[model samples]
Target chain A: MEAAPPESAAPITPVLVAEHLERKLPGDPPVTLVTDIDLAIEPGKFTAIVGPSGCGKSSLLYLLGLIDRPTDGRLLLEGRDMMPLSGDERAQIRLRHFGFVFQFHFLLPEFTALDNVMMPIRRLGRLSLPGARERASDLLTSMGLGDKLHKPPDHLSGGERQRVAIARAMANNPLLVLGDEPTGNLDSTNSARVVELFRELAHEQGRAVVCVTHDPGIAEVADIRVSMLDGRICEVLRQT
Target chain B: MFPRLGLLLHIAAMHLLVRRRQTLVATSGVAVGVGFFLAVSALMVGSQTDFVKTLIAAAPHIIISDELRSPSPQPGVREYGKTGAVELHGYKVRNEVRGIKDWQQILREIDAMPGAIGSPSLSGAVTLRQGGRDEPLGVVGIDPTIETRVSTISEKLRAGRLIDLERVQGGVIIGEDLAERLGLGMGDIVAATSARGVSRSLRIVGLFKKGQSGLGSGTGYMLLREAQSLLGRPFVINRLGVKLPDPYTADAVAKQLEARHGYKAESWQERSADFLGLLLTRNVIMYTVVSAILLVASFGIYTAVSNSVTDKRRDIAIMRSMGFSQGDLQFVFVVEGMALAVAGVIAGWLFGFALMTVLGSLEFPIQGEVRHLPLDRSTRQYLIAAAASLFAGIFAAWLPARKTALVDPVDILRGAV
Candidate 1:
């Protein structure tokens, strides 16, 4: 895999948009996590969300992935309003359209790497067992994990586990992939390899990618950079 | 969305396999509960049915006697209108002789009713005197041929036969217990005095052993004519015993007979109502014990599954985030609980069968007969146990599962990471 900046014109329409989004914990003196947020995510690009600690970057990622609902404002996917959908409906949209990679890889310990990757695909129920197995195998092989298909998560290295998690997120061939500091636990060599993979996934694979990270290298290489502070985005920078 | 058995079992099997010991403990708890329930119910209900059977065979289902449930209304009250009636001052009720003079007609009417066999007999108190012993007895005068068909007396005779009551002059059949107590035997003659003042010399022709202790020592049987002569009430039979083919029809038949004839009629069921009520109470207590055992077993399942939910919180969150619906998650855990119950039920039925077999093999001597402890090894008890335990398992599993599935998974995933 090779990493290069896209030579194509950016699309005008965003695949997903959040308008004035806000989430608050309900209690005495309610604590607000994300507030008055507006953002657009486009296909075929890697958008890096960079913020300091305690800046609600992860909270915003949760809302964007529809893993968490905003207390206020609206979330839209493909120009369709998502605020009216039920929780199960949101889950269905997530299954069909979005994938997530957490900082810890979050692979089920009892399952083999292939089984872990095939979980979401199997739940989608659109494919037969052999078909799902083949799809999961192909995704893992593309991520250079073909030989470790049967290995449990505990037996794999941190980078390999993270790659397996990535393959799982992509098992359904989602339109967008989201990661929360996925390489935070990896060595520099592994981190650089993950960075190259994200770049190739955005450019060659023609998929939208978003990562919440403190890694400056990801910001330097991303197609767009979003900076946040105090639950609000303060700046947005684009690669001409 | 609810998952089918394939996915449900896949996850459930993995969870159970991972915690084999805990699952086994839960299953064993249910199995023990089920086993004991089957064994205890079989024994208790078996005894109840056996006791009723004994009662049905021991006496006539209905007895019509020369008695009144209530006194006849005063003649003065029956005669005049209330406004014109005068009360009698210092009046005394007349002493009336108690005998069923129309017993023959009543017996024929009863015998004509479908499935009823009526035996005309006299019941009176008599005192018997031997060389050095005297015993007070309740003597029942029966026509041997008809009485034997109505009662189990033929099977209870230890010496001679009921027909001997007719073969000998003034013949009497005493229970062996009474004869043994008096040191008397067949062919011995004894003087019997009536409750009034009449007396007669009677010869012993038969001896019966009840095999049960209650009435053996005080009961004697004789020919109807001999008892009437000894009791000084010749030509009058005081009781008409009606035996029914189906003992369960006793109550209705007794009621119908009493309404037709103005005599006090009593069914054996009514006579033994208190005992049958006690049996019903015993059954309630037995089932309560059964429920207690299974309730405690259900707690074990609840604890096992609850602990699993707490321990697998992260895994649950991951699966929830993977788009498994709440129903789907609940299905996995519920299946695990029911699987434990199913295993327990099978194992428990085997254990119970063995226990019943062991109990059924046990024999004890009562009076003169050796009898095995009664055990109702009916299939219904197994089915009841299975239904009860499975329901308990499902309930136990459902509570904790709902708690885990309905919670906001974001919180669990957040806590884990």
Candidate 2:
């Protein structure tokens, strides 16, 4: 694996781009979730999508994460059009190149933190059992969850569970880590800690971190902040 | 791919383990179903086997009779090689001796056939007269050495060997029931009158029991020469009994012989077709009724997996978001169903075998003979039962597993979180 790029290095090409992306749900009057959205996500950067509830922040995040298809637009992953790919091919892309952390910290309660982290690694089928265990342990340890590796989600605290979810998202060493309100259920201090970890994952480890949030404090730590209103991006601000 | 499938199986197993009570209930349901299926199969198949065995033991595989099934050409009317233009007026059928002419040549041909043992027999209706008590009976004349090869009666003799019939010229072997009814013992002289009204005094040298009262009380066996003299048919035999190594091939062999010899050769299978058909219908009904149990048990599996799928919707969405494909989600639940089915099948086989053993050990009277319950021991029955349960389990799991696989993560996540 390549080492994380330094923050001061020369600019690199964007790994993911969405051009005029749109999503609409059929209804008596069709409900447009996100429309006319254009965004480019670069490696070694933390980007925040901040919006109020019902403003389609999570919807846009899902589209970019490949969890949901765009209604009408082109999505490019590594400059290759992802719209033409089949569902299974898209799933393969997600499995290899992207990881997702949801707001509820949806760790499988039956499994311990270590086993939960090993899920993606095992699904990818690139690592041996022992290798997966070692990598999961290392990821958890880096997240300051070394002592809580054996605890199931039901036994872990809210903050510890969310951190475990984050460790799981990074299990396959994905190029893009997408989080939808990852700190929405966390306390202030825990949320701050999670925000700092997200920054380190982007700036130090050279992976792109895209997080949807309602907290202004989390947006303050991002290299770029995107604000959405009425299903459209109102502003894109470069913070640093 | 195997390792990935293994992971899916592990996940499935863990899901079942976490809900141990539900899993046990489902597994036990299938086990009970499979166990009953196997037990019923064993009983049904075993009874059929016993029935065929009893039938084979009672008669020869094929019986060729001297009487032609179709009428022969009338005398004075030339047929086949000659031109038949002369018709006789007031022609009547002659009363001739009821016996096979040229039977020695026929028997030679039959005995020459592969896997065939042919024995000439003289059978006629007779009256047993002992101290004015007259009882109607069927008498069979058998060559002791040859008849022993074609029929089981020689093995079933109780009082004397079949060779005694050959040693003593007028020796007779009567059934025990017949002997008791006549109040006659061995060495007692009994007068037998044939259908042609020829009377002869015979010494009862042996008593045999045929296991059924109908056959045992009405049949008698005697030497061939004595029977021919009593029946007033000299140097003639009416029936040829043939035994074959493979009784099921009797029909083909009988057909071949009948076609060649122009005699009515009846195979035991042809004679017992109705009984065999009854057995087949009984088997179909048995399997249909038994398979219903497995179907009911599969419903139990469906219910358990359906409940799990409904309860694990959020987990499914999360896994999907984490890049698990729809096939993976479906495989996990399918594996769960198969695991339960496999466990149940194993337990069922043991339970079924145990049940068969217990039943087989118990003895009861059947047709005046002590016999144990017949239980088939072939592995085919077990495999069929297992395969049935597995198929049912997988079918039951399919809908719910597919539902789990097709779940949209966005809809679930938007509503849930």
User: Using lDDT as the measure, which candidate wins?
Assistant: 2
Candidates 1 onward: DockQ, in order:
0.38, 0.70
Per-residue accuracy of model 1 over B248-331 as CA lDDT, tens digit each: 999998999888888889999998999899998998899998899989988888988888777778888777776767777888
* Error at B296, model 1, angstroms: 1.4
Superposed on the true interface residues, model 2 gives a C-alpha RMSD in angstroms of: 1.1
For candidate 1, the docking band is acceptable
State how far residue A113 of model 1 sits from its true place (Å). 2.2
Q: Compared with the true structure, what per-residue lDDT tens digits does model 2 show for residues B1-417? A: 755776788789889999899999999999899888888888989988988998976888899998788867555443422864665678786666668887899888877878788899998888999988998878888899987777777667778988899888688888888888899998899998988889888899999865652365688888988888888888999998889888989999999989988889999999889999998899889978998999998998898888888888998888888888888998898888888888888888888888888888899987677988788989999999999999999988886888986688999987894
Cα RMSD for candidate 1?
A: 3.8
- In model 2, the Cα lDDT at residue A207 comes to 97
DockQ leader: 2
Error of 1 at A90 (Å): 1.3
